[model samples]
Target: MKPTLAPFPATRLRRTRRTPGLRDLVRETTLTPGDFIWPVFVRDGEGIEEPVASMPGVMRRSVDKVVEAAVEAHALGIPAICLFPYTDPSKRTEDCAEAWNPNNLSNTATRAIKAAVPDIAVMTDVALDPYSDTGHDGFIENGEIVNDRTVEALVKQAMSQAEAGADIIGPSDMMDGRIGAMRTALEQGGFRNVLLLSYAAKYASAFYGPFRDAVGASGALKGDKKTYQMDPANSDEAMRLIERDLSEGADMIMVKPGMPYLDICRRAKDMFGAPTFAYQVSGEYAMLAGAAQNGWIDGDRSMLESLMAFKRAGCDGVLTYFAPAAAKLLNG
Candidate 1:
C-alpha cells in the first residue's frame, strides 16, 4: 500500500514568501540600528582616521574624529558607541596604569563624545591589553596570568571609565571576580546607573587575531589568552561563566566573536533570559569585507544578514564593526 501520510503537500512553506507583507508577518526576528552598539577604535592624534589594515572599512579615529562619528551614529539611531584605544607603545607599561589614566585615549574620547554629543551612550572597554606591556588581557607574573591582582586593576579601570562619564562599562578581560569588584567599585564611586555589560562568554579563539591587529595588540602579544579566556571547545563552561558574571551584578552579558558561537548566545539567552548581547568580532568582519571587496559576495546583503543572525540567536544587541554602514542602510 502507498504511504498513508501522502507527503504533507498542503503545507506549502513558500506561501510566506509569496509577498512582502506575508514575509514580514512571519519573520521571527527583526534588526535595527537601535540593536547595534558600534565598537570604535580611538587613537591619540589630531585629524587622524587611520585605517585598520586587518579590518577593512574600520578606522582608529582621533578624539575629534570620534566626536564626529558619534554625532553621525547618534543621528543614524545607533544608541551606543564602544571605545577601544590604540595605546601608543610608549604608554604600554607593565603596570597598565595608563588604562585608568584620566588623560588616556579612551577617556579622552569618552569625554569629547560626551561633550559633543551627550545623547549617544558612551561605552568603554575595560581591558588591559591596550596598555599592558606584555599585551595580555591581565598582568603576567612569573609566566602566569594572575587573577585577583587583575581583578583589582579591572575595578580601577571600570571606575575610571565611569568617572570619565562612560554610560556603559564593558569588562572584556575575562578575569574572574572582576564583575563583582567593578560593580562594588561603581556603587561606591556613585555611578549607580552606569551599565555593566560583561564579556561573559568570551572564548580563546583564533578569530580574535584581526581584533588584536585593529587594537595594535597582535604585534605586542607575547602568548595566548588560553589561561583566562574560555576555551573554544567548551559550551558548558560558557554557561558557568555567564552565571558567575550575572551573580556578580552584570547589567548585561555578551558572547564574543559572535557568529561561530551563536549556539552559546542562544544558550545564554535561554538560560539567563537577561539582557544578552554578542560581539561580531574583527576577523568575521574582515572575512566578509574581504570577500565583498573581491566581488565574491554581496556586501550589503551579507552584512545585514549577519547582523540579523544575532537577533535570531536571541541577542538583545550586538557590538559590530558594521554598525555605521548597517545603520545608514537601515535608515535609507
Candidate 2:
C-alpha cells in the first residue's frame, strides 16, 4: 500500500529523519554481515598475504592464512566466503585440466576452510580463466570459444569443488547449459545439498580488468570475453538467462559487476522471485577505495552506503571485498 501523508505541517515529514533512532524505526532497507558473500584470493604457500596491487586492502593469502581469514570472517558473522585462486602461470594449459585437479589451489583452500571453519559456507569459483592459457572462461578451439566442450570441462571442475566440500558451487563460466550439466553431476555424484549460484547475467564489462589482474589473468588473456559473457547493452537477455538458469536447477542467481547492473538485479528478483545476489566486482571496489584513499570520499560512510544500495535494489546478498570492514561497522 502506498503511504499516505498529511498535506501540511501535520505530517512533519522530517520527524523520522531528525533522529537516528526514529530513522532506524522507519528504515525500509537494512544491511548485515549475513548479507555478504566475501570473495578472497588464494595463493599457494604458508603464512603469506600478498596485497593485490589493483584492489586496495585486498590480499592474496596462502592456504593456511586463508583458513585464518575464514575463521575471522565467520567470527564477524559473515556466513559465506568465496575463493578465487591466483594460479601459477606454469599451470595454465590449453586443456585447463588444473581446474579439476582434486588438490589444486582452490580445492586445497576449500578443504582447509571447511576443516577450520566448517560452519561458514565455502563458495568456489568455477571458471577456467585462472587455469587457462587463453585466460578465457571457456576453452578455445580454432579461434572460437566452444560452448559444449567448455560446459563439459565446467562439470568436471564443479565436481571437484563439491568433492572438496564446497557449500556453494558458483558457475561463473557463463557457458551455455553449464548449470544443468553441473546440477546433474552434483546430484549423481552424491552431493545433492550443494547450492548452485549461477552467474546467470554476467556482463563482459570493463569492470572485470582488476579482477583479471587479481587472479593473474590479465597477462595471459589472448582476446576479449565478449563472445561468451553477455553484452552490456542487453537487459531482456538477462531475464531470459536467469529464467533459463533457474529452470536448469540454479538454486540462486547472480548479476556480476553489481553496481552498474542493479537494474538487472532488481528485474531478476522481481521477475523470478529467487534468492538474487550481486557481485561488486574488483574494479568497483578499486574505484571506491581508491577515491577514499585520495580523500575524495569518506571511505567508511561511502562503503556502508554503497552496500546498503544493494539491499535497496532488491538483492538478497552481495559478493564484495569490503565484507569484514562493513561487518565490523554494522556490528558496532
Candidate 3:
C-alpha cells in the first residue's frame, strides 16, 4: 500500500527524514547493479584496450578484450552488455556491406562474448553508421537521407547480429517502418527469440559528439543527423515515436542522451508500460567524468545520483559507460 500523509503537525514529515533507516524505509525508488546495460566499444585486434580521450575512463576494447569485459560486467551483476564497433575508416564503404559481413568486429565480438559469457545477455547495435563511408545511419540520395533503403540495410544488419546470437538487437536508426521489417525478418530467419530494443526517441543532440569520435564517424559525417534523429525541442513527438515503435513489434523502447531526456523516458514507461531504457551517452559521461577529474564534483556520488535519477524517472535499465563502476558501488 502507498504511504499516506496526515496534516502538517500530525504528519511530522521530518521525522522520517531524520534517520538513515527511516530514509531507506520510505525511499520510493531504488537503483541496483542489475539495472545497467553496459555499452562497450569493439574493434579488431587482440588484447587491446584503447582509451577514448573524450570519455576518460571509457575504452574501446578489441573483440578478445570485449569478451573479457563482458565476463567482468557479468560478475559485477550487470545483466547485459551492448556492443558498438569502432570501425576503421578504411573498411567503411558507401554500400555499408561490412555491417552485415557476419565476421565484422561487432559480430565477432558478439560471438566471443556469448561463447565466454552466455549467461549475460548480449545486445548489438543495428545501424549502418559504423560501416558507412557516408557516416550517416541511412543512405544518401541526392543530398537527402533516404528511409526505405536504410530500413532494408538495417534488416540485413539485424539479421547478422541475430545470427551471431545477440539476445537484443538495438535499431538506433530512426527510420520509419524498420521495426516491422526487422521483426518480420527475425521471425522468418528462425531467430524468433531475439529482442528488438528500439531507440525510439533518439534526439539529434550536441551530446553525441563524443560518440561520433569513438565510432570514427566525426570526420566521415557529411552533415547533421537531425534529418533522421528527433529534434531536441519536441517532447510530444517523442510520445508519438515511442508508440509507433512499440506498435511495430519493438519489445522495448529507449530514449538516447539519457539524463537530458529523462522526461521522455518517464513518459514512455508510463504510457506504454513496456521495457523502457535510456542511453547515458558518451558526452554525458564526458561532462561528469571531466568535472570529477577536475575536482569540481564527487565522482562516485554524482555517478550514483545520476543513475538513481534514471530509476526514479521509470527507466527499466540504463545503457551507461559507467555501468561497471556504478555496479561495483551498488554491490558494495
TM-score of each: 0.98, 0.97, 0.97
lDDT (CA) per prediction: 0.93, 0.94, 0.93
Model 3 lDDT tens row, 59-96: 99988899999989999999999999999888999999
Which stretches of candidate 2 lie above 4 Å from their native place?
Answer: 1-12
* Candidate 1 Cα errors over 4 Å, as ranges: 5-8
Candidate order (lDDT): 2, 3, 1
Task: Measure candidate 3: CA RMSD.
Answer: 3.8
lDDT of each residue in 1-332, candidate 2, tens digit only: 99887676766688889888999999999899999999999999798999998888999999999999999999999999999999999999999999999999999999999988899999999989999998999988889999999999999999999999999999998999999999999999999999999999999999988888989999889879899899999999999999999999999999998999989998998999999999999999999999998999999999999999999999999999999999999999
TM-score of 3: 0.97
lDDT value for model 3: 0.93
lDDT string for model 1 (1-332, tens) is: 88678666878899889999999999999899999999999998899999988788999999999999999999999999999999999999999999999889898899999999999999999889999988999998899999999989889888888989999999999999999998888898899999999999999988888878888888999979999998899999999999999999999999998999999999999999999999999889999999998999999999999999999999999999999999999988
Using TM-score as the yardstick, the better of models 1 and 2 is 1
